[model samples]
Target: MVNRSQNVYIIAEAGVNHNGSLDLAKKLIDVAAEAGADAVKFQTFKADNLVRKNASKAEYQTRTTDASESQYAMIKKLELDEEDHQILIQHCDHRGIQFLSTPFDFDSVDLLVHKFNVKQLKISSGEITNAPLLLKAARSSKPIILSTGMSTLGEVEQALAVLAFGYTEPDSMPSIEAFHFAYCSVEGQQALRQNVVLLHCTTEYPAPFEDVNLRAMDTLATAFGLPVGFSDHTSGIAVPIAAVARGAVVIEKHFTLDRNLPGPDHKASLEPDELKDMVRSIRQVEAALGSPLKTPAPSELKNISVARKSLVAARTIREGEIFTTENLTVKRPGDGISPMYYWEWLGKTAEKNYEADEKVRR
Candidate 1:
């Protein structure tokens, strides 16, 4: 399991950018490892199981891919067989990064768990209402990262219920009664909490910044009390970086070997150098977030005396002279009495003579 409390789990989503070539897929893994991403994710699904032969492409897919081709045809060409999965997993192990793939169907889910032995499962936005897939993933006993896009709070609740109760019906609505029954026991709730993480996403390619609605991540966190993250589809790295600052525990962004590649997701995906910059920036942000307690930092401790004010003698004073506002004022080099004690020292007598511009002693 990923340590959500520390660094954000960064996923370089290399979704179908390989264009059916195992060599290209390995290259994507290499890019993700070199870029310092925690994992490289791909999509796992048989084209026949994923889409109908006559199903249309999404608007963004139509713009990026061949308009005349059916969605099924477009997806069929990108399918990676069983041997391809093994090769990629070996490559990921050699490259020193976790291998992850979003399973689009029940068979794909089984393949990921039984064959690849994935530690966690990532569900795409389109599967938010996929009840059978949800139950299957939950039954696998691996943690899940679920993306919510083009979905309402109620739909998300239904999906969670499916995971919790092992629901078999795909179209049934989730209710409070169902939730209560599923979690009536302590172990059930604990199991649910341990097995789930939610992700907020905008289901568009190169999603508009206005549509990103990053605040929804916090909403999901508050609502579910589970770790929340962002599946960013925006054109730049700024949004994901900001998501980290806003308490995102994970960040999933699409990436490609080259943006000019002919594929549905290539245009919106980050190139290699940009991926590195995003990881670097996220680490910098994590370092800068630091502790919640407001105290003097080690680096700033030395500057306190140089920058803060202290009560000092405004003019020369002889021994036993009465300290007054005219003889004492605030100045820098706070090695003596702090100016906060000014009023307390105002009518007192000086223990000894003091030169002008000298810090006053207690």
Candidate 2:
């Protein structure tokens, strides 16, 4: 979905780190672009649609924001209108970075896909079971990156079934049975292969390293035959870099101009400099991944003679003298008979006299 055909699609997620200021949001875009991210992402939603007035903030949100504030009140301050979305889209264009946003409601999805025309839709982990939203996203036909956190294999499969039904547009009405039928169909699987990318994520802010479960990422790739990526919520750059090394095809991590900035996600996000380091480190890991063949590298050829050992005369040996372990030994400068032939050379007559430490080039 993120054109993972090239390098891992690095998304510098600026999710609500802008503190609801359009200027701050623009600055975050600049930071992501400067850090060499493929895209900059923000959250798009109306507070009323996303949370109830009585809903309490999560434990981390309460710790980060006003403890007295309702979840709706906290998010209300951060809602970005359609006008703001357009400004961000324009800013991302100016900065030469792709724009992405997670849509929390159907209207937000329409605004992003139909109005601003973002290249893809980022579905957050909390929305994995939002079948209506997933179907709406697929009906739009823009590629989707669905995050799987706080979900099981069955739940993930169920979500994908909803997506498959929407992508295929089967004749029957949308229902659990229909979704399952579509998911089992060859045509539905093909549509999913072309339209969706799954991201393994830990939903908590500053997710615990132990909870990251990178092996589960491999499980995602095996269980679902689509490209898989990491939506990292860990404290630093290491987890994401390690994910790239372990075959993550895309990476999404949050960033903020300053971690001290008053926002729900800022404390867990990378500062400007750290974001750059993560991108640089991911690129380096990609280079290091290289080909899977177990062979010497191009740079290693010249060092073989210096580092590897070869058979050589341990002491002066006269011509016609029988070779033995005492008269022959392994030494460096491998431009001669390899040590692998030591057993064969034993008991064989020396073809010519050799000086001490001289390579036995037979």
Candidate 3:
């Protein structure tokens, strides 16, 4: 399990960018590990089981691939079988990075858990409504990261209810009131927190900045009392890096070997150098976000005396001269009385003589 509190768990989503070549897939793993990403994720699904032959492709998919081709045909060319899984897993072990795949069917789920031994399961946004898959994941009891895109809050609630109770049928389940009571209880909430994490996302590929609605991540965190993250589909690394600053415990972004590659997701994906820069920027942001307590930082403490102002004599004055606003002024080198006491210092007799541009004495 990822310790989200310590650092942002970064997953470079290399979905379908391998273009059905094992060599390309292994190269993707190498890129991810070199970029300092925590894991490299791929989509594990048999095209036949995932989509029907007649299913239409989304508009963005049509623009990226052949418009005449069906969704199944497009995805079929990208399927990775069991042998491919073994090769990729072994390569990930050698490269020192975690291997993750989003299972679209029950068999694929089992293959990943039983055969590949994936530590956790990442459920894609489209599968949030798939009851059988959700139940299978819940029974496995491995940590789950669920993405919510093209889904309403009620749909998210229903999915959480299924995971919390390990139930499939929504009609025969307990009432919403009872479900809330159980889910909010100490033990029940703890179990959910231990096993599940929610991710806020927009369903669009290369999602628009106006549609990002990053505040929704915090809303999910507050609503469920669970750790929340952002699965970014934006055009650049700025949004994901910004998500980290806004308290996303995990950040999943699509990446490719080259943006010019012919695929549905490559245009919106980050390249090798950009991926490394994203990781570096996220670490810098995390360090800059430091403590919550509002106090002077170590670097700024030394500057206080040099930058602040002190009460100084505006002109030369003799001993026992009365201090007044015309004779006293604020100046730098704040080793003397602070300007905050300027009002009180006025109308007081000076105990000692002071020269022009010198600090005023009480």
What TM-score does each of the candidates earn? Answer: 0.94, 0.98, 0.94
Candidate 1 lDDT over residue span 1-362, tens digit each: 56766789999999899999999999999999999999999899999899999999999999999999999999999998889999999999999999999999988999999988999999999998877787788878788999999989878877787777652332445555655567445555577687788889999999999999999988888887789989999998999999999998899999998999999999999999999999999999988999999999999999998998999899998889999989999998888788889999988988998999987886
Scored against the true structure, residue 81 in model 3 reaches a CA lDDT of 95
Supply the TM-score for candidate 1.
0.94
User: Largest lDDT belongs to which candidate?
Assistant: 2
Candidate 2: C-alpha lDDT: 0.92
Better TM-score candidate (2, 3): 2
Candidate 2 positional error at 33, Å: 0.4
CA lDDT of each candidate? 0.89, 0.92, 0.88
Q: Give each prediction's root-mean-square deviation over alpha carbons.
A: 2.7, 1.2, 2.7
TM-score attained by model 2? 0.98
Candidate 1 global CA lDDT score = 0.89
Candidate 2 per-residue lDDT over residues 1-362, each given as its tens digit: 37767899999999999898999999999999999999999999988888889999888998899899899989999999988988888988899999999999999999998998878999999999999899999888888999999999899999999999998983457999989999999989999999899999999988999999999999999998989999999999999999999999999999999988887888999999999999999999999999999999999999999898999999999999999989999998888888999999999998899999988867
Ranking of predictions according to TM-score: 2, 1, 3
